[model samples]
Target chain A: MKKTTQTPPSSGASKESQMLAMVNRRFFLRSAGIAATTGAFILGACKDHDLDPDMTVDLGSGDIGILNYAYALEQLEAAYYTQVIATPYAGMSAMEMSILTDIRDHEIIHREFFKAALGSSAIPGLEVNFSSVNFNDRASVLGVAKVFEDTGVSAYNGAGKLIADAGYLLLAGKIVSVEARHAAIIRDLLNPNSADFAGDDITDSNGLDLAKSPDMVLPAVAPFITTMISGNNLPK
Target chain B: MNIFKIIDEIQKVDGDAVDRLEYATRRSFLTKFSRNLSAAAVPAVMATIVNKAYAQSPAAIDVLNFALTLEYLEDEFYKMGNAASGLIPSMYQTVFRQIGKHEDQHVKFLAGALGAQAVAKPTFDFSAGGAFPNPFSNFDTFVFLSHAFEDTGVRAYKGQAGNLINDPALLEYALQIHSVEARHAAKARAILSEIRGNADIKPWITLNEGSPAQVYAGDDNTVQGGVDINGIAGKSKEAITEAFDEPLTKDEVLAIASLFIV
Candidate 1:
């Protein structure tokens, strides 16, 4: 029954919407403040961010464990993107710089959000081993970005069933799509307008994206992460 | 958008809903109207309708069938777009082919998963009742509609995640499809950016930025799990909104899907 309202939000209209949105945010936040201070879920063991790589950072089981798992991945991504932007690859174009910067900001936001959500249950800052990556080369930087983004997407996809809390599941649902978005852009940067953006290697004959369990994801990312991670406690 | 009308309709059904939604989490009700609200004055009634829609859903099968219906629409849309003569440029044929194949596969997967309970595929009108008179024959319109369809697919699967929570395996499957749809969305959005030469159009959605409004209604939401995503890492509101894709309600998604259904 709806038609002919095609002219979307104009700049002036968006500004007004932005103001309206701000008011809604305050009202929403004020009403939700007390309840949002959820009890900190205790996991296996907590470590200061400075913990040595030798120490096994156990991602505690259940819902919090999944959040930590996600946090760990986000940490890896944020760190990688941070370094990429700090010292960009050789011959990086303005578009590349702009896109990667946005990605960096996004990964950081995801990492911080999870860290905040998990509270004390969040795992310590993970130590990454980028010795194998040559940051100066665009190929090297983007290649790793692809791996991390794709891994994050699949890991979140696989971890969905393991998350018990509805809030947490919805949270994972929210972030995984963003990661998938990251994965696609990174892939497109490598091969613009090509099938590799959602290539057959990652997607199956049915076109379903790959989904890997914690066990599967941990090892895929193990090369980049030097810190010991224990996922044995994650929900089966 | 009957967002307010829906709220008014909801008030007739439940009285305390407005009060309850006032204190409820964004995932519950704000999510439904998150994208629907414009810069204009919003009535207090948006909350009750939000909560009612958020709180309602049937069995896993019901959700799956709802999903199957969307997959069917996408599958047929792509199948037609792919077959249209001189529609897709040669450079992007592979991209469109891959996306179409995935949609076809999703239809197969969901149908197989639903088995006998699967609903018959509805006849589709890609024009959206003449919204895009040349969706297949016109390249820009084709990609534009593809973006809308794929993005809608991502949100549609997400809106149903809460329903499948009780069945972990089912939920995981839905999520797998959900991310794949996201990947497709990213591909389509990127193609659109390249086509339209609009640098502002990133692969991820920025705010409630997409068309038809309903498909991308709540995407502008910066709040996640009760946390205001603004000021995190000194990111702009646009980046924060882009970082997290919000869930659309089943009712709104149906409103969108209805446009394409004959």
Candidate 2:
């Protein structure tokens, strides 16, 4: 369940140094004001479009909106999973440890995939601080885990329509099903009867539920993050 | 009289004609009075019209109606699947009951939202018009129906994501429900894999590889294909490997619903 450390590619390019440089540059940007703005301008050109100003957590345009919307959730999940691994929950069982580590790896992969796929259009890697979570308590950690995993699945389900690219949509389906798996495992671990699988909220008498837009999720996630992030420019 | 009473009496001085003239300068006093009388009677005449207009407006009521329908389908399927005792294992009864309860909760939640009664469950003919009949004769039936229901539930949630964006409370509620659906889908995939064995380890599971038949629902393009016997098509490696849910147009969802409703 340990994260597979990336070996330098056959070309011998060391990612460690490169990542260090990236971090240094990020620090430099945060401190060096007007002078750094020039480099930042160049970087911004290559940066993904920020969340759309109009992208409220509502569902209007399908596919693109959904993907950007999911980009946001992945951002949160990647952040959470990153912290959990950084600080292991106390009194963790061997099984919990293994599963959680695997989940972290999966979240990182998901986060990286979205970033790469989104490229210049993807959201900037968000800073997630889980100071409120008690890493020493199993209940606290699992409670947060349940909330996040559940939110991830629901976020994808709610944003499914806003995706435009068939390939991306397929990718989302693949990833979401995995998230669903994570949710079920966590649910079973939490309480036995909680796993409903294919119940009524999603499928209706007519077999349908609503997909929300970024406007809906941003405010909803406000309590979790320190800085405000936008979902406006996701997809028009 | 007190000073206030004196002021009141003076203020109440016959200003009715002046007020009438101020409101309608062009009208004779008699004509203005008559017009006021007519206008007063007009609201009573238009009350019926206003009520009719109000009745015709669609709200989240449409969303509730949609949920009501899907719940009926899900409820009936689980009930019927459980009833055919040979088709389901005794061990899995708890699973079915748990899922059934979720579906029932969903129905109650949606019905409560709509302030309406639950819709009666639909009679699903797993036999596709008897052309390629009931495929789930035993264990395969449960798997097929379970997978189909789970898959359909996931897609249906995707299909309806647009409808609940306005109300934050309901949006959160729907999201909570959606996560449960995803969990169900994953569990079903696991069960299907264990039951069928040699199941493809695709990222997403599908019923057919070369045909339009799917374990959940029809592909966007396949109009004709051999019907799957378990009421669901078998698994496809490519289906889940590269599978993502397709977002449907509002019109498209409406059309799909039309097939089930009278």
Candidate 3:
């Protein structure tokens, strides 16, 4: 007694175009490195800028810092899922395809939400390196998805306390539950009918979910992120 | 000299001697008397005062007790479902068993934290006052009710975060449990999807799902931060609904939970 609302596969196409745009822009910047730097210098030469905009963006401090940190992770996830759906794994069932697409859309929405919420303070689009993930193999792809989802959940759990703003804290709370849902689904696919849903690795002996600090999470995800993302400024 | 002996002697000599002493002399005597007590005794007194203060301010305890109640309900519901013969399919039996264990652990953890303040587990009917027909006996009814309970559990924890804001540790703890509930909700939804052959049943609650509609009422919200996300390019109303899980107020959560309570 239900109909799976067919979400037009726009996210996959949009992601492709976005990647192309980024590649073109990076190519332009690299070829005209001095010229681009000179232009940046002209813009900042008149004012005493604290640091070069080209340098690695510190995730700021306080609530904004936490938002940017989340934005970075969302960017990675959105990109990963976009690729997953754009080129699905071998022997992917129609059911698997549909759920992964839904996950893709959700991640894109999350990425855009953070981008719009943070606006200028938000870090530039992160370049993800999915070299380790073999998109053609179902197990390989799902393994990476599992890592990203689990890490995303723990990241939000860890960062929730660092957000002093009530609005931001509530937003994080809302988003993390979705992340947790995603994590569970992917885990069930990998190891069905097991305690992997709340696995000992991610949960404590008390059954409480693990809350990894920014420092702990950044490095784990860094291998997937090509951009030098830093969370040094996030609240302790 | 023992301070108690001295006080007793003074009382024996004249009942009013201590009271009639100069104010400065009495102050000095009390100061000396306190100094004679072990250093550890001070913190013991302070601990008693802090404990009393914590007991007095029941907001945190109330939040915990409320959580315990929900956990107890979930634990028992799962136990009944798992124990019911043929209610859960062989393929999904382990899943139910694992989830039931988690719920039991949650009850234990929350009860352990609340210590003596933890509320006793209430007897549950699961049939929702006849709203559901033999929920435990029937697998379909059991799955439907499990979905509701898990979804409600997620929102209940979300609603209590504000109350826990003052204590970061408690807030973090509540959030950790909150996500676990969401995961459980998703697992239940996935199982339903597998059984029904409907891919539309997402792990996250969408605007359209939730049997009574009240489970997902207000979850369709798209305008966050006063910006219409649905209006944005490529984003649909459903995407917004799936992106963020909506919170349920204490009244709303209890209302749903109360259905199962006799």
lDDT against the true structure, each candidate: 0.75, 0.49, 0.72
lDDT of 3 by residue, B1-262 (tens): 1223222221232323222222222233234335656776866654433332232224666677788888998999998889888789888887788778888888877766655445666667787768888898787788888888888888889878877655555677788888888888999888777677787787887874667777777888875544555634355677778888878887776667666665
Q: Candidate 2 regions off by >4 Å? A: A1-72, A79-123, A127-147, A153-178, A189-236, B1-63, B84-87, B111-121, B129-137, B163-176, B199-244, B248-262
Q: Give the clash total for candidate 2.
A: 48
Worst 10 residues of 1 chain B by lDDT: B6-15
- DockQ for all models, in order? 0.34, 0.11, 0.27
Ranking by TM-score: 1, 3, 2
What is the C-alpha local distance difference test score of candidate 2? 0.49
Show model 3 residue runs off by greater than 4 Å: A1-54, B1-57
- Cα displacement (angstroms), candidate 2, residue A199, comes to 11
Error of 3 at A202 (Å): 2.2
Which segments of candidate 1 are over 4 A away from where they belong?
A: A1-54, B1-58
How well is each residue in B121-228 modelled by candidate 2, as lDDT tens digits? 444555434532453456765665566566655666555544543332333344546546656666665566557773452213433331113333443222111111
Which model, 1 or 2, shows the larger lDDT?
A: 1
Quote model 1's TM-score. 0.79
For model 1, residues A53-171, the per-residue Cα lDDT tens digits are 66788887666677789988988888888889888899999999999988888887787677656555568777788889999999999999999999998899888877655666788
Candidate 1 backbone collisions, by pair: B35-B217
